[model samples]
Target chain A: MTPRLFQRTASAVLVVLITVSVLFPLAWMAIAGFKGRNEVLRSPFQFFPDMWRFDNYVDIARDPEFTRAMGVTFAGALIFTALSLVVNSLAAYAFARLEFRGKRFWWVYCVMPMFIPMMAILLTSFMVVTKLGMLNTMAVLIIPGVASGAQMFFIRQFYLGFPVAVEEAAMIDGASRWQIFLKLFLPQSAAPFVVMGIASYLAFWNAYVWPILTITDPNLTQIMQFLGTFRSARGNDWGMLMAGSTLASLPTILLLLVFQRFIVNGVRISGIK
Target chain B: MALTPTLAPGPQTADAGRSARGRRGRVKTPPHRRDNRTAYLMIAPMVILLGIFVMWPLVYSVYLSTYEINFYRGSTFVGLQFYRYVLESPDFWHSIVVGLYYSALTVPAMIIIALLLASFIKTLSRRAAAFMKTTVYLPTVVSTVVASVLFVLIYQDEGVANWLLSLISFGPVNWLNDPQLALPAIAVPGIWLGFGLTTLILLAALLDIPESYYEQAALDGAGFFARLWYVTLPLLKNVLLYLFVTGFTLAIQMIDLPLIMTNGGPSEATNTPNLYIFNTFRDVTPYATSYSLTASLLLFVVIGAISAVVFRLVRSDKAIDG
Candidate 1:
């Protein structure tokens, strides 16, 4: 083969190899969700099940604890996303558009928490939540996450690049600052808002340590903690475990498939910039 | 003032225009004050939330480090005793060493593998690249819990990992239960989960490199390796360093994967510092809080110093680039 052909063929092979490696475990999980416990344990490399089982999904759906945990996770993610957008956007707008004294100092103050690893503050944050008498309640999950430095930073970066002429024109028309922000800025910056919203939603949904620590009530438990404890309790039941895993992962995976572009853009913008 | 003549003149044109200009100037000055008010109003919620949750806790963590907190009783002062105790504890040192070892295993492996995958994908057709990108990135969307569960199934003695090993005539390996193999086994999923994001970031960096640079290199009789070395690596330096720093930070703060997969099993071989902190907090004794808080403070200091140095290096690179 010519050198170009050789290179092209090599690239294709490597790409296929990577695709398989990435997908196999996920594919196995999905497949194992349909397998019997015995088949899952005995024939680990079996590509297909002898018969598909819809009972696992039905069982998981009927499980009150699983359903309750899912509801808690969903509500937590939604509330966290909405509140984060409001709080972070307002702060971002102030940092981006308004001229204020001590702007630089406050900017640093707001953004500094991004550097402090969340694990490092786990205990103190738990204490703070405990002191507020918010433990085992949804408030502990939602309130602490309402203000995110990273979200504020990302939104601020988006706003900084926004055209000031639009807001300027609105001001010239006797529009109040609030009116201009409500009418113009929000509509214009919808993309970044969605990006941050989805990002925060996924984060809140996937949060494990905080929820595990705070919520001991089975009814208030998040999906991750539920799935983890469920696995530990029924370690030998691969079929049921994989079924629960698939259920827990389905929403985020679907979200990713739908908003893959925005997710990639968000990661790149936040990480690289 | 320069554009004042563009406006229509009225009966009291001169006075009206002068007053209009005066009014404009006066309007501008208070809006600055109004903007300040608005700014403060806008930032209040975030400021309050971050202060109560983050800033206060940060200070409280330090204070808690110096006290012996008991659940039954109140906190008692124990200035720097816990700190000294933690520093002297072999378990604390072991956890730090494990954290470093995990970082050493994952960071370079993630960077190199991610870079290769990114470069390879860059050579594919657009459609093929998109498919590969999505497939590779699929793992990242899976939560650490889910990933850990999946890997646990695979690493079991009769699972796919051993099944694959048997193909090469090797015996079943105790991937997680064996202390010697636990850390490395756990690092496998960590690398797998991490490389996709790193690859995507590197791909972004790679795509940002102008095609003209490659063409120019080719014109200068540069081969693929020469072009990559001369034109790509230099441009990718910042991104590579970024990946390294982030990867290092993540590897050190690893909690969920080890927590779920091994739970620092087989005698705490895979017990990261974060896990150590976690377990310390789980201790129900009166002095557990102080010890855990002290360990957390140590972690914070070490991570802070490392980040500060890495950030300094990044800033210096930007200086050189500018």
Candidate 2:
């Protein structure tokens, strides 16, 4: 083979190195989760458990705090994702189609919030949630996140590109603005909405800080942060943590599997270009 | 003046124009009711949610930022005192310097590596491209916390990383344990997670370049680096700018890795502004630590200012690009 082929082959090898480096930890963690405590620490080559601890799953499932936190996480993430969809879709339509005063100003302001750090507002957000007596509730958990800057920008960009002829033709009839919007605009904008849905779902699902801030009740803690407490310096069980970690990742992976096309498209179509 | 009337054109032209201009919201005749319904139906959900969640909370945050408001049992009308305190803090200053330092280190590294990787991908066969993309993007899909846990294991004294170094006759560097190595160690996983997507994006940007440009460059006797430096780099200018601006803003807002991996360890060597926010919010409160209103406001001002500068510069570039 030519030097060009050799170069390409070498580059692929480098990628494989990077890929193995990235995936090895995950494989190790998963394997170690099933291993006995001694095997996990003493031996590096033990790829699987000597005695498969299917019991770890049962052990974790029986823990009330674990199950409750998992429930809260699922509920909060799901609700936040739903709220984001509704808010993003509606605002996107207005920005795309409405001829309101200060539309440009509104658009800029809407997108500006997206750039603000969660850290910047995290403190104030925590205060707001507590003040409203919504602390530890999914109300606090899901509500604030609905105002997604990226989602608005995305939907707005997507809608801007969509053909406007359909809506105008609908308007030519006696249909009201609401009728045209619901009947005409939204049906065609499924492409973006689905994209935003997947992105928001994954984001809210993986989020850690906001949930940790707002939730004081163990019962209300999200699974990921709850799993964080297991990272003790001492003799904590790796099996339980890994088992929990594995469970924690399943929903997101499953969701991604179901919406691979849209999720990939969402990331691809994220920018204004 | 004639300019006054022209400047404030009537809505009638817009209404009339809407019918002829586009198709998405178009409807049957009796234009007034049809248009009104179309506007409302399309606009209601997004507006209401944005208002209730985004707008209201935003106003409240600003309001809280003005007052010395704790989560519970304490309140005072401080009149930007929180912002004042935040501006004065030593840690705040440190976070700013460190945040920029981290971004400066990470973004360029990712971009250069991503470009090279993308160049490689463009040369791959179709089957190879698909497999390569999937492998590359896998890290991104994994949760940062889980990755953090995995890394802590790798960086442990008995871990693989140190073990490899020993074999090579180089003394083992305590990666996460040592303050100096902690920042780079913390940054590595993010680069690993980030490189794949950037590679794919630049590859798309690369694919848009016609093969004719390369042939012309070859005919002109420009070497690979010369062709890339002169032709490919210039064409990728806009994409690069986009990457830089977005990359810079995101690096400043980074929370996950520092929060999980180091917990800003080794005497706060890796403490990021975002991690500081969490610490303030969730710290060991003897009697419920005050709401991070002041700290948050400062962060908001800092982040908002940074984003504004980035966006302003990029917008001007966009105008030029257009």
Candidate 3:
């Protein structure tokens, strides 16, 4: 066999192996959600369910805890995304376009948080919110994270790439600075906003540690937090848990399918969370 | 004289077309003054939020770490004592070791796997590569909560993992329930959840390499391995170091899996430093709060030191590259 052919075959095998390793567990989760309780835990586990069950999903849909958590999480994440887009872009636009005193110092100040380990702040943030009597409130969950150093950095990079001529043309049209930002820059920055918005939304959806620390009220529980405690409370209900996880993951999966490049581009622009 | 407005452009565009009506310039403040006011106003929300939540908390934690607080009796100052206590605690040290162990397991392994996968995918057709990339990256979008539950189910005695083991005549292994096997068990999902991002990042780096370099290496009688060793690895040094520092920092704070699956489990084997400190906070005693705060500060120092070392490494590399 030629060396090139051998190399090609090896690459193919690696791709196949990785693809299976990734997809198999996801497949298992989706498939197991349809299995009965007995089938899920049965010895010498059957690869496929004997009889498919929609009851797990149906029961989950009707579960008040599940539905309420979903609603609260959706609303909280939406508020966070909107506020983050505005706050991050406002600062990013200034950094990219405007000249101010202490510009360098402020930029450094904004980016410094990204360098700090999140755990170091976790305890203190809880303490601060507790001291302020905001504990167990969605405000605590959403407001504290609205100003992100990474988002500003990513958005600022996007803004820096904008053609100066566009801004010049807008300025020449008798637009105030605010009008230029709101009317022109915001509309033109749709791509970055969408990417950052999706990223922020998904992040808030997946947030566990903060919600776990701040919220003890079950009624205020976010989806991830609810799913976690639900797992422990509903122990041995593998079917229900799988169904819960599937329900939780659906939005992100749908978002990924629709906006693969935006998600990928978001990662490329900002390394990782 | 036709009065022209001298439009003061930004410093970045200092060379812009400067012919304008100088007469209108008399009526306005300098352009930078207008900019300074608007910029400050625009950035006010972020600055205020970060200052209150992030920066203030950092300082407050330091203050909290120094004192022994009792709500009924008021707070008492014991400077450096809590720090000493945290530094001396065997459990604290053990948790640090556990965090390091988790990092050791996941960081290098993820980098190596990602590098290899990136290289392999580089060999594939673009369409096939995109399919594989998306498939691998799919899990990244799945939250840790969901991933943990999935793995918990998979690692069960009667689950697919044991069934696969039985194919080789091995018995069922206690994965998360066993103290010895627990951290490593958790690391498997960590790798799965993270490697895709690293692969995609590395693949982008790999794709950026000029193909002419490879063709030139081939002309010099370089085999596949020779070319890869001489040509590829050096170019990838910066990206690898970046992944190293960030990934290590990320792995050291491993809490979500342990929180959900093991709850720092069997013998407290999977308890990372952050998890240990969190549990300490839950103790709710004055000493516990101070100890946890001090320990968290120490964790910050460890991460800071790691970052500093990477920065030095990068600086030295830039010098050598130059």
Candidate 4:
């Protein structure tokens, strides 16, 4: 074979190897969700279940705690994403376009949180939330997390790249600042907002430590925390565990499938910038 | 002329408005002043949230670190005692060591694997490249908790990992239950979860490299390895540094995966600093709060110093000019 053909064949083999390695665990988990307990444990090497079972999914649906955790997860994601977009975008817009006294100070202050690891502040932040009488509620999950320095920074980068002429034309047409921001800037910023929104949503959805700390009530448990406790409680039930894992991962996998381009673009832009 | 009054209102107001409009158009005062007010309004919510959540908690963590508090009784100031205690504790040092070891094991492995995968993907046809990218990146969106659960099944004694090993005539080895193997075993999922993002970033950096460099090297009769070493790696220096710094930062804070899979068990071999802090707080002992706070503060300082040095090194030398 020619050198080019050899290289091409070698790369193709590597690609197939990588694809299998990446998908194997996930595919196994999905398939195991449909297997019986005996089947899962006895034939761990088997690619196919001897008999398909919907019992685990049926059990998950029938359990109120599991269902409640799912609800809490979705609600947390939605509220956190909405609040983060509004708060971060407004701050980002100001940082991008508007001039104010102490602007540099505020900008630095807002971006400082990104440098400090969240674990450093976790204990004190819990105390602060307790002091505010917000602990043990859903408010604790959503409120403190709504303001993200990283998201604000990304959105500000996006806005900085946007042209100012559009806003200038709107101002010349007698539009107020708010009007121009709403009609022009906001419309132009859908991509970044969607990017930030999905990011915030995923963060809230996947959160474990904070939710576990703040939420004591079983009914209010988030999906991740619930999964941890569920695994401990049903340590022997591989079928249920796989089913729970599948349920926890389904939303994100679907989101990836539907918004593959947006997710990729978002990660690239955020990392490169 | 007739519409002037309607557009600008009464004569006195019209002159004032005309002056204001003229100032807005030419000078930077009128519109800027108005925007300043609007800007303040726009940023108010974020400012308030940060003050209450981020800024206050930052100062409060330091203050809390100096105090020894008990839930049953009130608190008393124990200035520098907790910090000293934490410094003296072997467990604290062990946690840090484990964190560093974990970072050492995972970050370089992830980077090398990701770089190779990314470079190979770059050589593929567009359709093949896209498919490879999607499959690899799919794990990135999976929650750490879910990924841990999935891997726990695979790493079990009778699980697929051992099954695959048996295909090569190796005996079944306990991945998570053994102390010596626990940390490295846990690093498997970490690498799996991380390589996709690293690959994507490296791919982007690779794509940004000009093709002329490769062509010039080829014209000089450089082989593939020579071109990769002289052309690609040099161009990718900054991006590689970025991946290293961010990857190290992330690896140090790993909590959910080990917390779920092993719960820092097998004689605490996999206990990260973040997990140690969590357990310290959860235990609620007499000085647990202060201890946890001090550990966290120490972690912050170490991470901050390391990141500062890395940024300085990476920023000082630019291999590729934009």
**Fraction of true contacts reproduced, model 1?**
0.54
> Model 1 Cα displacement at A144 (Å)?
0.5
Q: Which tens-of-lDDT digit does each residue in B124-188 have in candidate 2?
A: 78777766666665666567776776677667765667767777766567888788888888777
Model 4 C-alpha lDDT per residue in residues A10-99, reported as the tens digit of each score: 888888888887898898988888988777867448878888889988897778888889988898788888988899889988877776
Ranking by TM-score: 4, 1, 3, 2
lDDT over C-alpha atoms for residue B90 of model 3: 95
List DockQ for all candidates: 0.47, 0.31, 0.47, 0.46
lDDT of 3 at A240: 83
What lDDT score goes with residue B66 in model 2?
71
Query: TM-score for every candidate vs. truth?
Result: 0.92, 0.83, 0.91, 0.92
Q: Give the alpha carbon lDDT tens digit for every residue of A1-273 in model 1.
A: 999999888877887888888888899999889988788868446768889988787888889888888888998888888988999899988877776777768988997877777766778988999999999999998988788887777777677666778778888899987797788788877778877787687778888888888999878989999888876566677898899899999998898888777756655554362
* Candidate 1, superposed: residue stretches over 4 Å from native: A1-9, A271-273, B1-34, B318-322
In TM-score terms, candidate 3 sits at 0.91
Clashes of 4: 0
Q: Distance from true position, residue B108, model 1, in Å?
A: 1.5
lDDT for each residue of candidate 3 in B83-202, tens digit (9 for 90 to 100): 889889999989989999999999999999888888888888978887877887798889999999899888999988889999999979988899999999999999988888788878
The collision pairs in model 3 are B4-B21, B4-B22, B5-B20, B5-B21, B5-B22
Could you give the fnat of all candidates in order? 0.54, 0.26, 0.52, 0.53
Q: Which regions in candidate 2 have their CA more than 4 angstroms from the true location? A: A2-15, A43-68, A232-235, A271-273, B1-84, B282-292, B307-322
TM-score of chain B of each: 0.87, 0.83, 0.88, 0.88
Structure candidate 4, residue pairs in collision: none
